[model samples]
Target: MQESHSNESQIQIRLVTKQSEYAVPDIPLSVPANIETAGLNELLNHLLKENKPDFLKQKQFDFLASGELVRVSLIEHLQERSVSVETTVEVEYIQVTPAPQPEDSILHEDWVAAIETANRWMLIGCYDHSVSIRTPHGKPVTSSKEHKNIVKDVAWVDQQQPSKGLVSVSHDLTGILWAWEEGTDKIEPRVKLRGHERGIDTVAVSPNSNRLATGGWDTNLKIWSASLDGDDNGEPASKKKKGPSDISTRTPIHTLNGHKECISSINWTNNHVLYSASMDHTIKFWDAELCGIKNEIVDQKAFLSSSWSALSNTLLASSADRHIRLYDPRSTEGSVCKVMFTSHTLWVSSVAWSKYSEHLFLSGSYDSTVKMWDTRSPKAPLYNLQGHEGQVLVVDWSNSKYLVSGGTDNYIHIFKNKQIFK
Candidate 1:
């Protein structure tokens, strides 16, 4: 009876893969039902040993059974899901992305609240009331100390131009535009924007580089001309009293109002379309031409940050609920919330989509960690980045070669992607 039971414990599994390079023969192999993911990977690699490159021998794989990752023993997963083991199990395999390597850790004087990378430059905003520009390798170039309060956000205006532009928002309720040509000694302030009744939390440059938008704690979104060629709106900024600085002070051309609470984040998708997330538990889509809300996705938790992917036409947003959500605004049949990635233990403070891969993104959380994710594998993140000692405030994957993140720990951590994912 014991010999008969032992023989019955064995199951047949047929391995398959969508990756052409890793494809194996579709023959079923009998193995112990107690085998786990690592065991299966070893077995699959053995099958691909013949006629394969040396590098392929070192690669790892992930297995999926019935559309779910096989994280436990084969028999355990099948029994938990009430799957029948009498028949052959068909498992799909995918190449596992190696963990990103730590590249550099840049120290900051205060909490690193915001970060952006593009055009071979890295821009970081700090609670020390400064915005600093640095090389991709963490060499400081120039910085600006014109903001009176903590710098909450920063953005690159035009990466295609010879000279780059910058916009920084602060708790002082103002946004400053600056000019910095490569190798310049200073980040010269060009214009000072004042209109938000409360501290500005987020800023986004338009796709065309002709306009910019800002959202603040006053529950308002404002748009302004990004042109630095114009003279001061009124009198010379240097001659003004109790307002304006050496640079001009300009008011927003349009004020968008709909959120019932603070506007936490804003992103511009095109010249005429934009989106804003609010503490009111909603993400609103607006038509910039009409200056009104066109559609919205209501959630139970307050949104902390947002990112729009031009490649996928999808919206990614983090919330106080500690989950990162992927939404498809084009879906009119059901809920806009498509996938909810629930791994972070605390509030998800920021999210960024990979510019090179439509299916890849990153999320930083108050739990003091950053996670790399692929939209195709929604069940789990590809990697969990651990470096920050405090809440991670922002993450940037704008650069194809680098993944950058900043946190309340007063440090900017950079990682190099092994695969560029292009």
Candidate 2:
């Protein structure tokens, strides 16, 4: 009984491989208590040599306990599983498969012009001159009526309300604010912002949702109050008929003019600092408080899209040269990119930095591919996600788990990282 009790303390490990060609037998071994994954790996390698000598150098194997890829020591896993000698442990040995591909693809009508998400809702602007809001689970909530021309971009206004407000810019030379109430299909257009001399191209809401900025073909960036009454209610002082000139009475707080050509993109890092990119091959940083250009970055090539990282001091821009450039504002090199990633064969139209990773970003190009990049490896993309039949116009990383992309193919693809679930 004493010997049997001592033997019961040993852990029984079973090796299971997925490959049918290997013909590995179900080799079970009793290991002493507290054996870690490293020790188990060494034991498996030895067992493979004894069973099939030639298969030893074929491929490397990773051990997973109870469907989870093992990264911690075996003792930790055992403690997590609460395993004792009374139960046998099952560890799956899988050949390192490439990173999991996108789990699902969602189809949409009209070219996807822009996409933005917050919490449970995602806003999509379409080239069909309309916008639609949907849940991440792929359920349509509401769709807006057609604008005069193509919808260029969309932004979600951050507020302390149960239902959020939406702002969309269009090539019809106007920006529209819409009210979206949760648990309902009613989408009401609240205001029509008509201050841009030419067609508006992009719009951004400030971090606090108190200010809004729009850049346009007139080579200007205009800032406006996010709310009509300067309150969280988003209600106008008086109920007025909605028209192209409805909100024309309101004036811009600041009219920023520095770009030589059409403004391509705009981003507000905070309430006071705004970044604008242009076809003029320059990016200008504005101090909203002082109403002055804090810094201007000039490039030899045109910048199609630009995004500021909320997690770091890095700025990512996609250029017509089919390259994504990373910039450090604190660097002495002016606007010169600290690192450049080249993978796309055509013009890179949009770039977005991940909110969850400081060194990760996503770029979409005319080549119909959205490439995920890690700044540490500038030569190659971490993943080349292909689904769009035409140019991938925009790509956005949601809170942290999902990647949403829109393209000229009139499709929106939502990708999930399986590792994030584990």
How well is each residue in 216-318 modelled by candidate 1, as lDDT tens digits?
8999999888776453332343433432235767898889888899888888878899999999999998999888888889999999999999999999999
RMSD of 2: 12.6
Q: Tell me the deviation in Å of residue 237 in model 1.
A: 15
157-200, model 2: which lDDT tens digit per residue? Answer: 87234275888999998888777777578777766777788888
**Where does candidate 2 clash, by residue pair?**
37-74
Whole-model lDDT, model 1? 0.85
Clashing pairs in 1: none
Backbone clashes per model, in order? 0, 1
**What is residue 406's positional error in candidate 2, in angstroms?**
1.1
Residue 313, candidate 2: how far off, in angstroms?
A: 0.9
RMSD of each: 4.5, 12.6
- lDDT (Cα atoms) of all candidates against the true structure: 0.85, 0.77
Clashes of 1: 0
